[model samples]
Target chain A: MTTAADSTVQSAPVRPFAQALKDAQTRITTHMDARLGGDDALHAAMRYAVTGGKMLRGFLVLESARLHGVAEAATLEAALAIECIHAYSLVHDDLPCMDDDDLRRGQPTVHRKWDESMAVLAGDSLQTFAFELLADPRIGPHGLTLIRGLAQASGKDGMVSGQMLDIAAETATRPLDLEQITHLQNRKTGCLISWSATAGAVMAGADEAPLRRYADALGLAFQIADDILDVEGDAAKVGKAVRKDADAGKATFVSLLGLDAAKKRAKTLMEQACDALTPYGDAAETLKDTARFVISRDS
Target chain B: MTTAADSTVQSAPVRPFAQALKDAQTRITTHMDARLGGDDALHAAMRYAVTGGKMLRGFLVLESARLHGVAEAATLEAALAIECIHAYSLVHDDLPCMDDDDLRRGQPTVHRKWDESMAVLAGDSLQTFAFELLADPRIGPHGLTLIRGLAQASGKDGMVSGQMLDIAAETATRPLDLEQITHLQNRKTGCLISWSATAGAVMAGADEAPLRRYADALGLAFQIADDILDVEGDAAKVGKAVRKDADAGKATFVSLLGLDAAKKRAKTLMEQACDALTPYGDAAETLKDTARFVISRDS
Candidate 1:
C-alpha cells in the first residue's frame, strides 16, 4: 500500500519538514524496492535490512537535489544510493565481529534473523548495489564524481577509518580524547551526511562550497545529537540499546563534552548549519529546517 | 623488487604465457600498491591481503584489454579494481564465519594476522576501493558500464550467490548434483572471471559475444581444474590447505564427475575457449594461451 509520505511527494512541494522527510523515505524506499525486488531469499534479506530506517541520509539527498533543481528521477536514484550505503553500513556494523548487536530498529539484526554468512553476503551485496545505483547512466557524467565521493566518504579515509578507531579504542589503555572522538564521529557519521548534503551541488556542477560548509556543521551536530540521545533515549522508543558507549567507557560527545555542553554545542552548530545555507536563501528552506530537526529528533 | 613478470609486459608482444601472467601480476600489484599507499593500518591490511595471489583474474583483464587495444593505463586500473574485489572476497571468505580457512597463499589470513573486525573492515574497504577505482574518470563514459557490470558480477546474483549456495550445501541432506554444482561454480567462480575476460570488449564497446562464449567455458574449466588440484595438489605449492572440499564431503566437480572425467571435461572446455577466440585470431593468442594455462596450472 502507498504511504502518506509517498503521496505527499507525488503531490508536490512545500510540505512540513517532518512530512517532507517521511515523503523522501517513502519515495526512496519505493525506489529501493524496485531496485531490489526479487522473490529470492537474498532479496528478502536485503529489503528487510533496508526497511525501518528514518531515511535521514536519503532526505538529505532529496533536499539537496531539490534545492539544486535536479530532476526527481535522477535525484531519487542518488537518494537510493546513499540510503543503500547507509543501510549496508548498519548491516555490517551489526555483524557478530563488529558491534554484535542483536536488535536494530526494533527488529532482529540481519545476522540474527538469518545466518552470519548470509548477513555477510547480504551486506556485501547491498554495498555493491549502492555503487550499481550510482553507475546508472541517468546520473550523467558528473555521477562519476558522486560515485568517487561516496567511495572516499564510505571507504578507508572516512567511515571505515572511524570504525577502526572506535574498535581500537575498545582495547586501548587510555580513553580517546575530545579530538579523537570528534575525528571518529566525523568519519563514522559525518562523512556520509556531508556527502548526502553536498550531492545536489555535485550533480548540478554548482559551487559545493556552501553545501559543504552547511554539511560540515550539520554532520557534527547530528552526531552530537546522537550522543545526547544515547544518554537520554529510552530503548523502547530508540529501538536499540542506548548508553552502551558510556557503559563501555568509550569516548563520545557526551562523555567528552558532558551532556549539557554537548547539547549547547549541537545547538550552536545547528545554527551554523542554517547560516551556511544563506547563499541559497529561500531556496534552502527545507535544508534549514532539516538542520533544526537534526538536533530535535527523538529517534 | 621487480619480478620476471614485470619485465615481460614492459618489453613487448608474445611473451611466454608464464611470463605474460607474471607481468600482469607485477603491473597490477604495482598499481594496487600505489593506490593503497596510505600509512594507516587499514592500508597495510589491504596491501597484505591483495598481495601474493597468482593474480590470474587480473591477468585475464589485462590480456583481454590488451587484445582490444585499450590503453595500458586504463586497463591497469580495471585490473586493480578486479584484484581489489578478489582480495576482498578472499579476506571475507577466510573469516571465522565463512570458509574459516586459516591459511591463504601460504600465509596467515587477514583475520588471523590482525583480528576478525579488522579483516571485516579491511575486506569491506577493499570492495569499496574497487568501485572507486572504476569510477576514475580515466575509465571514461564506459566506466559506468564497467562499474555496473562489476556490481552485477560481484553482488547477489553473481559471486555472493555462489557463496551462499556453497554455505547452504554444508548442511543439506542431499549432495548437489553435477548440474547444481555447475550452476554454483558458475556464479561463485565464473562470474568475476567472465567479467574480467569480457572487460576489454566492454571498454571498447566492441562485440562481447565471442569473449563471453570463451569465458563461459573457461570459467567452468578453471573450477574443474581447481577441484582436481584440491585432490591431487600439494598444500605447500597450492598455497592453502588442499583436499578440504573432499574431506568435508562437498559435492565438487571432482566428487560428482570423478577426477579423470572432470579433467577431461576441463580439457574439452579449454578447447572450446580457444575456439571461441577464432574471431580475434592471432590478436587473442595471449588469451588462448591463458585458457590453456587455466587447465594446466598448479595453483
Candidate 2:
C-alpha cells in the first residue's frame, strides 16, 4: 500500500532529508548487525525481524526533527532507537500467542521464520538494544530523555497495556462502543507513533506542549486510517491478510461506526493532525502531507 | 528446599545486616504496590513473580551496597530495579512456549495463573519498569551505570542469549564439551547474578574493576551449584518439576562432569569468589557467604 508520500519520494529528486533518513537507517542497520553478532541463524532472525517494516515510525521521527530545524547527530541515534523498539514490538505482536499474524511487510513473521522461542528472544534482545543505544554516552545525555519517552510509550502505560485491552476486547461478548474501540486503538497503536514524534522533538529541543499536541493528533489519525484500510484495503496490494478484524470478531472503527462514518472520522482526524502542526507553519508541510497520505490512500 | 541460611535466620534474632536486607525488600515491595495502581491482574502477576524467589540477586545488591557503604535510600531503589528484572526473566522463562513449567517457587507459574499473552506482556512491562526505575534522577549519574550493566547482562550477551543457547543445546546430537556448557551456563545464570553484585557496587560508587571480578566469580559459582542441586534435588522440597535436565538429556555440569566433580568445581569457584573479595576485607563477608551458599544450599 504505497502512499502519495512514498511515491513522491520515488519520483521526485531525492531530497537530502530523505537521503539523510536512509543514511541514518543504514548506520542503525550496521550497529544492529554487530549487536546481534553470532552464528547465521541468530543473526538471520535478528536482521529479518528488523530490516523489513513500514518504517513509518522512523519517518515520523525524521520528519519531526526536521520540523524543529535540528539535524543533530544525536537525533539520528534517538530515531534509530525508536525504530528498533517499534520493530521489536511488531515482532512480538505477531507471535503465535499474540496476534498470530504469519506475515508482516510481505514476509513471514519472525516466529514463522525461526521458531516461537527464538522469535521471543530476538524481540526481547532488540527491545533491550533500543535502550542500550539510547543510553550510549557517545550520543550524550540526550539519550536519557529519549529512553524515558520510549519507556513510557512502550511499557505498562503505553503499548503493552493497550495490547492487553485489545486482546480482552476481542474476547468480550458485548460490542464495544466507538469510544471504547478508539481508546484501545489509541493506546495500542497511537502511543508508539506519538512517542516517535515527541521523542524527535525532545531530541531537537522543541517546546513541550506543542510537541505533545502534534504527537497526540498524529497518532490517533494514523490509527483511524489504519482501521479504515483494514476494511477497504486490497489483500494483493496490502501484502497481508485484510479484514481480519471482522474475521477475528474484534471491534474496529469500521465495525463500530459503519464504513462511511469511519471514512469521515478518519478524514476529520487527519485534519486535526494537520492542524496540530499549524504552530510550525511551513516547517511541518511534509508532516501534513503524511497525514493526508495516511487517510486518503487505498491499498 | 529451605536452606541453612534461611533456618539460621529463623532460629536467631535477625542480625542488623539481615534486618537491613528485609527493610530494603520491604521498601521495594511498598513502592511496587503504589506504582501497581489500578491494574489488578498485572499487579497480582508482578507480586507473584517477585515475592517467593530466594532473593539471592536482591541479597547480593543489598549486601554489596552495604560492603561499599552506600546510603540505604539509594541501595533500596537499586535493589528494586534489579529484582524486577530478575522476576520478569523468571516469569517469561516459565511460559508454556519456553520452559513450560507449571510451578515456580512452589506456586503456579504466571502463565498458569494468567493467560500466556498476559504473562508475556507482564514480563515485558516489568523489564521496562526496571530500566525506567534506574533512569530516575534520584539515583543520579550512578543510576545510568547500574542500568547499563543490567541491560548488557540481561540482554544479548547475557541471559537471553544464554537461553537461546540452552534451547539449541537441548536438541543437539553431539555432546557439548565442558567449555561450551560453561559458556552457556555463565551467560544464562552467571550474567544476571554478576550484574546484580556489580550494579550494587556501582550504586555505592565502587565502579572499579576489582569489584566486577568479585561479582563474576560469585556468578559462576552460583550456577555450578544450581546444576548440582538440579541433579540431586527432591521435587517435593524444591517445589519444582525436578529432573527435567536429565529427562531432556541436557548437558549440565552435573551430567558432564558427574556430581562429585561438579561439587568440587563449585567448591573451587567458591574459594576463588572469596579470594576475589579479599581487597574489600571484612566488609565483604556477606558476599563470601553468598558464594558459599550458592554451592551448599538445596533450593
Best by DockQ: 1
List fnat per candidate, in order. Answer: 0.80, 0.50
- TM per candidate, chain B: 0.94, 0.89
- Give TM per candidate: 0.94, 0.91
* Best model per TM-score: 1
Instruction: Write candidate 1's Cα lDDT for A1-299 as tens digits.
Output: 22222321012233478788888888988898777766777888988888999898889999888888888878998998888888888988998889999999999999999988878888898899999888888887688899999999999998999999889889999998988888998999999999999998899898999999999999998898888888898887888999898888888888888888888788789778878998997888788777777786777
Off by over 4 Å in 1: A1-15, B1-15
Residue range A1-299, candidate 2, lDDT tens digits: 22233432113223444454466567666655665567646556767877855566777777777676555555556666777778778888898888899888788898887888877788887778778777777556556667777888888877888888888877788978888877877778888888777766676566756666766776776676677678777877676789998787777777878778776776677667767876887777666666666665554
The interface RMSD for candidate 2 is: 1.3
What proportion of true contacts does candidate 2 retain? 0.50
